[model samples]
Target: MSPDQAQAQGRLHDTDPVGIIDIGSNSVRLVVYERLTRSPTVLFNEKVLAGLGRGVGVTNRLADDSVERALAALRRFRFLATQAGAETLYVLATAAAREAENGPDFIREVQKITGAKVEVLSGRDEAERSAYGIISGIWRANGIAGDLGGGSLELVDVRGEEIGDGRTYPLGGLRLQDAAEDSVRKAEKIAADALDGCSLLDGGAGRAFYAIGGTWRSLARLYMFETGYPLKVMHHFAIPAGEALDFCRKVAREDLAGFEHIDVISRSRRALLPYGAAVMEQIIRRAQPTEVVMSALGVREGHLYKLLSKKERARDPLIAASEELAILRSRSPRHAGELADWTGRLFEVLEVEESADERRLRTAACLLADIGWRAHPDYRGEQSLNIIAHAAFIGIDHPGRAYLALANFYRHVGLIEEELSPWIRKLATTRLMERARILGSAFRVAYLISAAMPGVMPKTTVRRRNGELVLELPKDIADLDGERLRKRFSQLGRLMELSADVEIA
Candidate 1:
């Protein structure tokens, strides 16, 4: 295709790039998304920690040095967003700019520099946006969502699609650090006192505590590193309440430098770790949640998600992302959709027990099955596995991500355990591993029969007969079935502990 044709095809169903310039208490960030998608893809993301809220606790004014740094960052961000083809730029300022005495001056300067109207979010607005972010990223999220920023903490109750009014506290990392005079004990007391008898957290008992913002994400990263977790994906990383409480206590009271992985964190963020941990410890103590879940989404994503139509908001992020990938990379996107239906029918005929969530994952895997077809034959599985395993996907847990990646891997490389990575295996349960194998085996058989095309797989049928799994090919395509297909079919049957045969309809 010509350059123009290629570009036109690429932008067919894609919306114009949208940019978000978030001026937070701790950092000034610029994120240009591919579009206002359910699962927005970050085309460009950059942040500068200007400590905009550093002196706000005591002086109640945005510091001069921080203001200069922030303004400089905004100027550059405006240029970068334009270069990135961002059609619209949404500028949002949180706690620092809203609370500080000199906040209005800073906002005016930002508006002038970026040539965009700045929406200084109120505490309630911040909390609501953060909650919306959790709703957008996590499927059927049920629990309390908390965003710990540099200047404040926003907490709100979330139950599926319903979100309660948000409450804000002055328990931000920088604020707490300043209030406690860098003393861990005082910080702990301050956090405890602020969150004491907070009704929002009271509703969080036995539910999830979704942690948002950079400081909390950094804290989760530390935990992930310390525990040697297999998948590095941050969203939906859950830790039990008891374990998280203990870890937070250690981080709050103990010396952070004593930890071996402390070096992994940025030096700029190291000082605030204790404060963040202290606040988290207080939250856990108060809420008694079932688990503390980390959410990478926050006010920025929430704001974007709010702009989407209600119908668009209701789409499953994982499936939408998977289908988008298939459309962009697969040989035939229609074939991928057909593959999903075909597999569903096969599972139904075979009486495979699949939960609603599992079926959703299987369908996502089907959509993504052929995404790696363009890679070299020998390395297709490895390439596809890496892409899906670490893709910027949301709404699915790590185990589901593993299933999708493994199914495609198995489709390309066959169901061979020896070739799989041990770390990836550690992420999924035994049941999921087996399901991946079965789906992979199914993909192998389906692809061999259809040649990655549409219509063929739908026409063929698989059924159980006389204690055997039989694959029936219509008379017209009977010549297409042979020893190779029979061998693949038998391999699939062996995994299910059944004999298999192929016959002409």
Candidate 2:
């Protein structure tokens, strides 16, 4: 059987050491997983239809009863997770929580009660994780996979099971219902345009379509019922495109009664089946895949799989990737490397002692500091911000971390855009800011060092001197640039409230 079949049939290994609690629009679910001798295995999985999305479209707040029920479920899952000895309890809140007014507050409450700090994911995160899961689990070869949920529909590009960059459109069934007609048309245009723009589908002339989520499953079920697909299983079943399109068109024109023959689609979901199927039809028309498969695993499984992977647990993936990317993509790797070496040396004497881990992250920050130049010299800084914001690096948690890293990269040019200043304050702690500052300072000095390199310059050391501070450099190094290095350190010292003096060695 195919991976999709195995997953749907619960035939694959189920031992999982990680636990994930997914607070979604329609329900709250928790899964505990451990690694078996075989593939990652699921230990326990349970779902409760808390309907956190109920009334959210109109009220813009999670219903009180829904929140209570959801929290109760989480409170129980907390025990199960702990009982299973889960070290990393990855808690994620989807559309329901992200759009609610008191979402952050409720998240804090859950953390306090369950000891699970929830990472309320944006729709993009939802799409990205789902995409990764599809790649890692079912379609490891190459194809486009999509997960259409009650809250949102996520589109992904896949190379077999390997995931590539994908985009998310906010055209979920619930959201589509709330959106204006013009808005719906605009969203369709945007989704199609984005899909067409992506290069992942370039070589996917006629690949299988791996579908996941309730909407797709429902559509596939309706097809199975109508076509009298011998078995009820949809994992590897082929729903022909013509019949699939026809079924969708028929459903689109029918009332709720037209779906009575299909029992798999619940009464609650019957009304939205037409719209959801319309989305399916839209993508299928564009993709023109040879066949379609359904996925039973998505975000929860993806979260578990990711945590088990060597990248997230054994080492930091982003730092590792950044180091390699820096060397491969930098305009002047040699110069950049030399400047980084000098910067490290200068930083040692500069009073702030960073840990090995901090230094590693800093090195990564330094290496990719020039990546922005790839886009355009004039807007390199902006490009840097975008790369950090969207790149699928190993260790990043949210866009804020990327923003923090990118902001430091821009500081290499000697100016911080004031508009981003508030975000820096809001997002970063004092320690994080200091690290960013050190990285910025190191890069700036490195740039100057490269310019004066292959020529005799000064040796420098920075340290705390008599409660104040001073950077002492060899006379030749200090004199070559005429206090250029000293002035920069002095500015940094002042900004960080440390009085600094530049003394000739």
Candidate 3:
């Protein structure tokens, strides 16, 4: 490799690329993450549907052809993991591998091929890990987390950081499909029977039900496409219980090919949608959750989260992710930190009433404020908006994502509603929209004063005194103030409904 390539590789090595081989009943997936941070970024990810538990319910053994396909995929994944510089590899086998008669033998072969210890999780173990994945991704997750794989469904209760014992059922898509002979009516009966009188779901009443697994994600995607949802993000996508129940009933009972946007789902996954929907419909009917929230993270991410120290686990995932981006893409990470503190102090002086969650979102926006500086001056706003809107960020919902994106866009392009997309505006509340404009205006003023440097912002102060917003610049940097700075400060003052002044202190 060239010296520059070698140097880049060395930098990546410091972050520690970790690989996970998830052997599920329906698919074998390999995901190599850039690092094992709270909001882990994927370096490479690939999956192959192997249907390892196709007939395990009746046959009690993994299918021969399915085993061959899984092994082939495992071999390729092992090589790919090494190529991606993954020094650590974790192989986790879910319901199919633990239940099949030949599961032990299959696991041995997997260990040999991948040169890693294979962990065959029990039903409870699977549930806990899936719940941990939810905890890692969502902020203070509560309610039941159900992971519906091809072989089994693991349900566990979570309240904040506490995870309850989980129960497993044979309601997985492939297993249910086989048990019901591919009949939707029969699938519904089986799902009802499996979930009937399950005390684990009792606590989920009036709370959220976090859905995991590919089939459910596919279902969520179909929902997004059908509703013309503005944001395409899947994580934290929420559907009201009544609405989800009705939708699931339709998906389970109706013909899949007839759906308007059925093409959004892969053909391989289409056959199992009815079965998956049947199971989800039963859960919502029985649990009566307030809403169904989709989670992109699952067993793999959960397993990695378990490896962190208590201190690391305590950090806010959204802040950690934003800081990482600022370090990688901003003109100065230190300046971003300073800007966050400066804005925070300004908000307090202006008596802005902000909730704890709103404060966190604002800090994250500040860290991400300058990531698009390298883009063409004219298109910087558009590029920043698009990138932040669609970034693979967790611990936040759709509205929070919109706030971050809109704040940065306003910072770059000025606070003008006409230039913003109505679709983006639809995601945030009116209060959040106004707050975004205030933050963006503040950023405009800060950048002008600091030139995106570190030392200046810390020494400057913005305060409200005697019916005016006063920006007190330290005398040494007083000359940095200009007509453009005054105009930007005035814009911020207008947003706060206060007169603006600049004073040399």
Candidate 4:
């Protein structure tokens, strides 16, 4: 491989894109991420449900039909990987391949066809990856990291940050349903043996069972639908422990027609819902977590995390990445530079006590604050939201950072959405909202001041006057556009709970 290609495939730290193809019993997926010093951009992502393990458990071999379907998908993935400029292909195979007789031959054929070697993961490796995925996304929990795949289930004990004592069982939904009841029980016992006396999980007893994998996520979606959660946010939605158990109970007894209401749940998964629910219920009973935090960040993010840490160091990778992207795509780099300098100076003069990351995110917001000018002048707010919402920004998480960016952009165009309130609420703390609002309002003032004469700097500083924030304009500024500036300042002052005034000779 060339140096550039080598770097792209090497690791996320190398500031190049990387591709990962995960071959599981139910589906085949390929993801290409453009990794930067702080963030990762998803260049391409798609999945196909090959059901590679549909009948592998009973047959003890991958069916000829399944092999053909998987091979075709792999070929398509190869094309996409190359198109994405991905230098390396990391292929991980789960249960079906590990248990099937023809699995080895299939992997070899794939290597010949796509020149991408497939690594058939042991149940342990699969469990480890699942644990890593959970840890990298959510807070480290003292409990079992469970991932239920189509053909098998793996559980790993995670204590603090370390995940150890993993075991893979053949009693996955598909496999368990295929086997005799006695065999299923036997498989459960074998799985139970792996966690027989692990201490890490002892702490989790009566706490939450941090649920990971498609099965539990499907359940969470069902719960969200039932509860009427406005947004389909998965990363931080905490389903009460009792609610999760109740949902499991409902799924365990519900018939096929019952799941039709869930927009994302498929008919194919209907048969497995009861079994998957049962698996979760059992785990929940064993290593109880405080609540089930549906992890939106998992294996893919785990791989990305491993890659990013290998890159340059940053206090918060997520924040750093967002800042980098904002700077890279900023349309007015020069204006953004000026805005940041002025904003920094203003904050310093005001004695703001926010952390570096908070300051950085604000600076980033100012940089991309004017990107909407590229879109139609009338609907720049809508255009700005779309750009930040869907941009393939290297190293930034979608929604979270995008919301912060949009909040700033909307200030320039006037806020008009009830929908954005939920997103603003997801910022973990209300203080974040307050900060964004203050910065956003300030940006609006700066934008208006700059709109009249692009580079004209305000002569006076902003300060608390009586009960309002008032801008003290320079004599020349007051003479040129004093009234216009005063009106703007009064509007902002009232909105931000302050007063406005200007002193001119």
TM-scores of the models, in the given order? 0.97, 0.52, 0.98, 0.76
lDDT of each: 0.91, 0.63, 0.92, 0.65
Best by lDDT: 3
Tens digit of per-residue lDDT, candidate 1, span 1-505: 2354347655433467899999999999999998888889898999999999997999999999999999999999999998888869999999999999889988999999888999999999999999999999999999999999999999999888898989999988998889999898999998888889798788888899999989888898999999999888899999999999999899988888889899889999989998999999999999999999999999999999999999999999999998888888888889999999989988887788999999999999999999888899999999999999999899998888889889999999998789999998888888898889999999999999999988898889999987799999999888889999999999988888889999999
Better of 1 and 4 by TM-score: 1
Model 1, global lDDT: 0.91
- Rank candidates by lDDT, best first: 3, 1, 4, 2
**In the order shown, what is each candidate's alpha-carbon RMSD?**
1.8, 20.8, 1.4, 5.6
lDDT of 4 by residue, 110-202 (tens): 787678777888887787777766666553355566778888877777664587777776757776666634343444454455445545556
- Tens digits of per-residue lDDT, candidate 2, 134-155, equal 6444523357777776566677
Number of the top TM-score candidate: 3
* Candidate 4 lDDT score at position 8: 48
RMSD of 1: 1.8
Candidate 2 RMSD to the correct structure: 20.8
Tens digits of per-residue lDDT for model 3 on 1-505? 2354357722334456899999999999999998888889998999999999899998999999999999999999999999887879999999899999999999999999999999999999899899999999999898899999999999999999999989999999999989998798999998898889899888889999999999999998998898899999999999999988999999998888788999999999999998899999999989999999999998999999999888989999999989988987999999999999999999898888899999999999999999999999999999999999999999999999999999999999997789998999889998888889889999999999989989899899888888899999998998987898898898888888899989899
Model 1, TM vs. native: 0.97
Q: Is candidate 3 or candidate 4 better by lDDT?
A: 3
lDDT of 4 at 263: 56
